[model samples]
Target chain A: MGIIKLCGMAGLIITGWLVGFKKSADLRFRVQRLKKLYEETEELLHRLQYEGLERDRLLLSSFSDFCLVWNGKILFNESGLTAEDAVILKEMIQKLGTGNLETEEKRLLYVLERLRQQESAAQKIAVTNGKIYQTLGTCAGIMICIFLL
Target chain B: MKEDALDAVLPFVHQSIGRVFLFLPEETKREVCELRLRRNLPVCLTLPQGIRYLFKDGTIDDRPREGVLICTAEQLEETFFLLCKRSVYAHAEELREGYLSLPNGCRAGVCGRVAPDGMVRDITSLNLRIARAVEGCADSVVSAEDGGGILIAGPPSSGKTTVLRDTVRQLSKNKRVVVIDSRGEISGGTERPLSLGVNTDVLLIRNKAKGTEMALRTMFPQTIALDETGTAEELKGVEESFHAGVQIVTTAHIGEKRELLERKITRHLLASGAISTVALLSGKIGEPPEIFSPEEL
Candidate 1:
C-alpha cells in the first residue's frame, strides 16, 4: 500500500511537469507568432511613411501651393500634431513659396527627422510590450504547474 | 477750364486715344508725349475741354486730338461708356473686326458676342493689350544662329515679341529682315516704325492675314521674322520658305521644347529639317533672358 501511494504521487508530479513544459512550448510558439506579426505591421508602417515622404517631395517640387494647403489640412486633422508643429509647418510653406528650392528641401528633411523620432518612440513602446507579454506567458505557465501540483 | 468740362473731355480722350494723356498736367503730358513719340506711338492732338460735347453723340466727326481713341478694352466698354453715347462705329467692334491698331503697337483685344460659326466678331467686351516694343530683345538669337529656322517659345507675358524684335535688329545688321507685323505689336509702327533698325524692312500685315503667303510674295524677305505661327497653311508657308532657301525666325506660344515638337506646325518644321535650332526664352523682360539650344536638351 505504501509503494503504490508513492508511485501515484510520482505519476501526478510527472504529469504536472509535462503540462508545464507543454504550456511553455505553446507560449513560445505564440510569442514567435506575435513577433512576426509585429514585424510585418512595423514594416508596413515604414513603407507607408516612405511613400508619404516621396509624395510630399514630388508635390513640393511641382505644385508647392497644393502642398502647403494639403500639409496644413493634415497637421490640423492629426491629433498628435502640436501647436508648435503647426506653426513650423505654416512658416515652412510660406518660406517654400518665397524662398529657394534648396531651403524648401531642407524643411522637408526636418519633417522627416521629426517623423523618425516619433517612429523610434513607437518602437521603444513595442519592445516594452513584447517583453511584458513574454513575462506574463512565463508566469502563467508557472502558476498552472503550481495549481496542478 | 471748368472741372466738369475737364471731366467731360477726359472720357472722350480715353475713348478716342485708348489712353488719357491729355488729363495729365503740361509737364506730365510733355514727358508722356516724349515717351510715346520716342516709342513711335500715334500722336494725339491737345483739345479744348469744350470739344467733349461733340464726341458725346458718337460723332467722331468732331476731331479732338486724333479722331481715334487709344484706350484699353476695359476702359471703352465700362467706365468710359457713360461719358459718350454708343456710336455705330464702336472702337471696340472695329478692334474685334480686326482693324484699328492702337498706339504703342497694341491692338485692342476683344471678346464676347461670338458669331454662330464660332468667329470672334462684334466684340462687346474689350481688353486693350498694351504692346511695348523692347529694343535688343532678339540679340540672343542672332549670336546663337546656325543658319536654320528659329522658334521663340514662351508663355504669355514672358517677352516673346521683345526677343523677336531684338532678333530682327541683330539679323538686320547682316541680313535683310522682312517682318510680318500681323498685329503691329512687333514694330509698333502706326503709319511707319518709330524705332527699329534702318536696314529692317517691315510689311505691316497689321490685322490677321495668311502669314506664309504674305511673307513669300509681298515681303520676299531673305530672312523672315514674325509672331505667333499656328496654322497648317502657315506651316506650309514656312516649308515654302525653306524650299526657297529663305531662313525664318518666328515666335509660338508654348512652355517647353518638347511641347514645340508636339505642335503640328513646329513638329513639321523640325521633322522636315526646316528648323535647325530652337531658342527657348524663359522669364520676363528686364530679367536676363535664358536661351535654350537643341544641343542643351
Candidate 2:
C-alpha cells in the first residue's frame, strides 16, 4: 500500500511538471508573436509617414495588422492591444509619428485668429488714412472755389 | 496621435519649411541641418513619412534637390562661411562676398549691410535662395546641322538652365563643347561635372565678367556656352567668337522672340549673322516644354 501510494504521488508530480512546461512553451510563442507584431507596426508607421501612399489597400493592410495585435480592442489595455482597437491605434500611431490632426486644427485656428487681428489692424490704418485724405481734399476744394470766386 | 491627423499635419510642415523633412533620418537631419546652416542652406524638420510621400508622388525627383532656410542672420552667416570653404579656391578677401554658390549650381542670394569698401564685410543679415540643377534639359535645342550659333532666352526659373544643360549634353555627343560657367549652372558641377560629356570642357569663372573673351582667347572650343550676357563688351565678345569661327551658344532673359529681336544688342548680334537659331523656352520644369525658333515666331 505504501509503495503504491508513493508511485501515485510521483505520477502526480510528473503530470504537474508536463502541464507547466506546456504552458511555458505556449507563453514563449505568444511573447515572440507579440514582439514581431510590435516591430511590424513600427515599420508600417515609418513607411506610411515617410511615403505618402493614399492607396486604400495599404491602409487596409495596416489596419489588419493592428487588428491582429490588439485582438479587436480599439482602446488601450493593461495587458496588450486588442483587435478592435487596431484602427484607433493605427490612427494614433500615424498622428504621433507624422503629426496629430488636433494639433493641425489648433494651428489653423491660430493662423485664422492672427489673420483676423491683422485685418482689423489694417482696417484701422485705412480708416485713419482715409480721414486724412478726406480732410486734405475738402481743404483743396474750398481753396479752389475761393480762388474762382 | 491619429494616422489621419499625422498625414494631414505633416504636409504643412514640409510646405512651411520648404524641404523634405520626413525621409531624413534623425542622424542625417542633425548633420544636414549643421551642413545647411554652415553653408547658408535652409533646413526644416518634418516627419519621416512626409519625405516618402514626396518621393513616391514625384514632387522630389531622384536627383539631389538643394534647399535653403532663412531664419536669422546668424544662420545665414554660418551657411556662407561653409559655402566659401567648399567652392572658393582663394583666400576670403579674394572671394566676392554676399554671394554663395553650391556645387550643384544652386546659389544663395545674400543681402546685408555693405561696408564702405564695396565689400559685404559686415554681413549683418542674409537671404538664402536655394537653386537646383535639372540635367538632360538641353536636348531640345539640337538642329540637323551641327555648326551654328544658337541663342537661348528666358526669364528667371523658366527652365532655361534645364534646357541649356540638355542642349549642351546633346551637342556634346559630336562637337567639342566648351562652357564658360559664370555661376556653374550649365555643367551642374559641384566638385566635378557629372553630366558634362567627355568631349565637353568647362571653365568655371565664378569671378570673371568677360566670359566670351575668355572662351575665345584661352579655351579653343568649337562651341561656347555661357549664361546671362548683359553688357556691350560681352556682346562684342560674342561677335568676336563668331569672327573666330567658333559657334556660340548663350542665354539671356527676355519676354519673347519679338522682344529679343527688338533689343539693340541682340538685334546687332543676330543681324551680324552670328546667331542662326533662337530657342525660346517657356513654362516650368517637368511640364510640357514649348520650343520656339526665331523663324516660327
Off by over 4 Å in 1: A1-149, B1-75, B78-100, B115-124, B192-194, B206-211, B214-220, B295-297
Candidate 1 CAPRI grade: incorrect
Candidate closest to the true structure, highest TM-score: 2
Predicted candidate 1 versus true structure: per-residue lDDT over A17-64, tens digit per residue: 565555455445443433433343343234333432322343334334
iRMSD per prediction, in order? 23.8, 19.6
Kindly provide the TM-score of model 1 when superposed on the true structure, using C-alpha atoms: 0.46
Predictions' DockQ, in order? 0.00, 0.01
| Tens digit per residue, CA lDDT, model 2, B1-297 | 312212222222224333444554444332221112222333432222222112321233223344334335554444444444321222133234555554445444455555554445444433333333345455556753347888787766566666677677778888888888876656755553447667788887753347667767777888887776667777777778888998888777877667787887777767767777777766443554455545565
- TM-scores for all candidates: the values are 0.46, 0.48
- lDDT for every model? 0.52, 0.51
Query: Which stretch of 10 consecutive residues in model 1 chain B shows the poorest summed lDDT?
Result: B31-40
For residue B271, model 2's alpha carbon misses the true position, in angstroms, by: 2.3
lDDT (tens digit, per residue) of candidate 2 on A117-136 = 44454445445654555455
